[model samples]
Every structure is written in C-alpha cells, then in structure tokens.
Target: MSTETDVDGGDTGDSLTLALAQLHVDAGEVEANVERALAAVSRAADRGADLVALPELFNVGYFAFDLYARNAEPFGGETFTRLREAAADHGIAVLAGSIVEDLAATESVETPAADGFSNTAALFDADGERRLVYRKHHLFGYESAESELLVPGETLETATIGGMTVGVTTCYDLRFPELYRRLVDAGAELILVPSAWPYPRIEHWQTLSRARAIENQAYVATINGSGEFEEATLLGRSSVYDPWGVPLASSGDEATLITTEIDPRTVVDVRDEFPALRDRRR
Candidate 1:
C-alpha cells in the first residue's frame, strides 16, 4: 500500500486499490465462513489491495432467519475479534461485511427479545483496530422477515481509509438516494456497499449502484454474496464503479475476488468538469 504523501501529496486527492470479495457464504456455518473470509483477505493483500470489502452477512447466510438468534453476537465480541485478527494479519483495512448483532432493547421499544438483533457491519484498520460500526438502516421486508429480526440503524458513518474518505451502507440502503447525499455532504469520496442482494433483482442492484456513483460523483464499490439460500438465491454481481459511473470491474454469480484501482482525484476532476452537483436545488 502506498502512503498518503506518495499518492498526490497533501490529501486533496489520493488513490487506493480496493478488493471486492464476492464470496459464497454457507448458511449457519460460522467457522467455515470465517476461513473463507480470511482466505479472501489474504488473496487481496497479496494482490496489493489496500482495502478489502466483503459481502453482507458473510459469517452466516443472509436468508437464514431461523438462525439469527442463535448466531447473533454483541458488538466488539468474538466475531469482530476474529475479523480484527484477519485484518491485522493481512496488513490491510477490512470491511467485515454485515453481521447479526444482539443489542439491548429499550423498555418502550416493545420488540420481542429474540427479535432484537441489529444488522451491523464493522471496519478494522491494518493494525486490527476497530474503526467504525454501521448497522443497516433500511430493512427489506417484501420477501424476507428482516424487520422482524433486525433493528434499523440510527447513524451514518464515514471513515478515512488509505487517505480517502469512505462511506458505508448495506444492501437495501442502495435504493435510497438520500443516504448517499448525506454521505457526500459528509465529504465521502468513495462509498462501499456490502450486500446480499438476491437474484431477479439484479437489474435494480446494478442500476442503483451506478446511480449512486453518478449522482454523488464518487467511487462506488458493491460486494455481494454468491450462493443459493433455502428459498432465495444471491446474484453476486459485485462491482466497482468510477466517478463518471463507468464500471471498473464486475464479478459473476461465483465465488471470486474483484479488484480495481481507483483515483480519488478523478472524482474531483469529473465533478469540476460536469458541475452537476452544484446545480442541485433540493
């Protein structure tokens, strides 16, 4: 990984090599999933990737609702501890995808005790330090029972990785433009989406991801899972996009690693050339 001074020398613009781990997570298999994630991280670091992003609910299957209560862990618990070790071992920043977390519910909430899990994502630095925790704010309810099992997140977070300000959101959050707008206002130059978006909605997944990049004029990289669940199937078209909404790399419905080099300066250049963001009234 290159230093901040080596890229553009000052922090106005920088470059980073990002790896999208389009993995296939096993349902209810935590140990196996951790091994797969660790192997992917090692491969990404060997390829000179500075930051590695994984798919949503990577430690367990996304649609495995029957196992949520049994698999859920508290924040900063054992699951995150393993991820932190993996990040440090690879000497690369890691986006630990999304996990099911058990958070204490307020008395007024009245949600069921078994249904008090938070769909959360964790980030770790090269030294295995916890950097950020982002819980999914938008809960999808058409085909699944996410709302019944997971609580919505209240805050949006932005962090610095490899000298670039990066924002985070989960699967359904991609459909909400307001979230990306808020991240842009927070000075996010790149947005990372970890998702478990399934098949038959691949078009929506691809289109929304590109739209976020185009509207925000920032780098957008989405990592998705690849496998068949009990009643649904993941599409796993993990991709990376440039500031001009051009695709840098995309994966198929298979377990693979997608890598791309991004220049943060290009975002500034494109925004300057187009000036579309300045024309927004609302």
Candidate 2:
C-alpha cells in the first residue's frame, strides 16, 4: 500500500475509528469462524470503522490444543488470503488475529520436524496487501502448554493504518509492559490486543488492558472471544480504552462488535498534558 508516514512527523489531528470483533468462534471450524469474522467486518465497515480487530485464535478456539496440527496453515495460506480479500473488500485495515501457523521446521534447526506451528497474528492493509505478521511472543503457561506447541515470535512489528501508527500483540502479551514500551518506542500511537482470555480472570484482563493504556499513554483496543470450550470458557469483555485509560466502549459476555473512535491527537494531548511517559525512570 502507501508508504506515506502519518503518525510520525505529521499532523496530530489524524485519527482512526476501530471495531473490536468479539466473535464467538467454534473450535476447529475454520470456514464458519472466517464467515463470522467477515460478518463482523461488514458490520464495522457499515458503521464507518477505519479498521477492525478480531480475537486471538479466532478461527479455531483457544483450548483446542489437539487440533493445532490439523488446522494449522502457513503464513500466506488460506486464512491470510481470505483476510486480505476481506480487508480490500471492506476498504478497512484488518488485524486478523492469531492463527495456528505451520512453519516449516527445517527453517529452525533447533526444532527440526518439517512441521511445527506458531501462534501468529496477520495484518492486512486496506489495499489487501499483507503488512505485518506478529507471532505471540509470550505464551501463557498457567495451565496450558502453548509454549510446547507453538514457536515464540522473534520480533515486534508495527504498521500505519488510518493515519495512526499501530502495534499488535496476541493474547498473553498483554501482561508484559516491556513489549508495550517497545511498541511506543517504535512510535506507536495505538495498540491492538487480540485475545481468547478465559473466565475467572475477567478482572485481570480488564485491569491489565487499562493498565497498559495508562502506562503507555496510547489507545488500547482489545478483542476477545465469547464461548465455552471443552476445557475452558472464554470471557468476552472486549474493550477500547483511550490514552488516559478511559473506557471508550466495552462489551459484556456476548458475541458482539465493539466500536470506538480513536483520535491520534488525544495521545499527544494526554501525554502533553500529563507528561507521564516523560517522567519514567527506566
């Protein structure tokens, strides 16, 4: 797409309207899940959203560990192709959340199998061009063995969309503040978090998301799934927070699309007014 820089060394009035697709995805149903995400995108576009963000592992439910090998697709495979088409069709940037990616194990001699998987997030610009791919760097290990099944990401990535510099992270990455700091260092004005966060930790999800926005002084939009799996139930509380840690729009335990208007200027205004980031010691 266009290589013009919008957020950096540009007018602060630039803003973006975002839609968080809190979809209810069924485990192992790729087609149905893709259709659901497409419907959400259409709705978001109709509402004048500049970009849409889907939940982590949206095509296949999070707890479906056994299905990772069976449902995995390569980086430029069908899942990403469909997302690119949808982004072009809707004329909006699409953050097609995390997917189980089958990376040729030969690429990494440490894990030689010819078939390994990674939890990767794919971003497609409005022109249907693949922009960035961010694999989940920090895999959760509380009760799940995601680290064992998925390869950790190597680099952080950011992109320009709707006149805003945006950074992306998958489910468990929200807990790490350093990652967010790195994104901000890369001139990110907005952060998109795609998660399949489970229940009994709703408070943590909300608290951490708000904390990230407050600390980074950037707009944070988190999209989570809503459904029950054989092993866990997803806590669907997708939300968007402003730079000042204000909840612009949020969702409850249901399959719904949460939309919010984010002004990139607000990040500048909040940081200028509060100057929190400037006073950081580390």
TM-score for every candidate vs. truth? 0.90, 0.91
Error of 1 at 67 (Å): 0.4
Q: lDDT, candidate 1, residue 259?
A: 74
Give one digit per residue, the lDDT tens place, for model 1 in 1-282.
101011111222246888888887889988888788888889889988889998899987899999988988777667777879989988999999988887763223322244478888988989998777788889999889898888898888789898889999999999899999999999999999999999899899999999999999999999998778887989988888888888888877888888778887788899999999999998
Pairs clashing within candidate 1: none
**Candidate 2 lDDT score relative to the true structure:** 0.83
TM-score of 2: 0.91
lDDT per residue for candidate 2 within 161-217, as digits (tens), equals 887899998878988999999999999999999999998998899999999999999
- Steric clashes per prediction: 0, 0
Candidate 1 local Cα displacement, residue 5, angstroms: 33
> How many backbone clashes can be found in candidate 2?
0
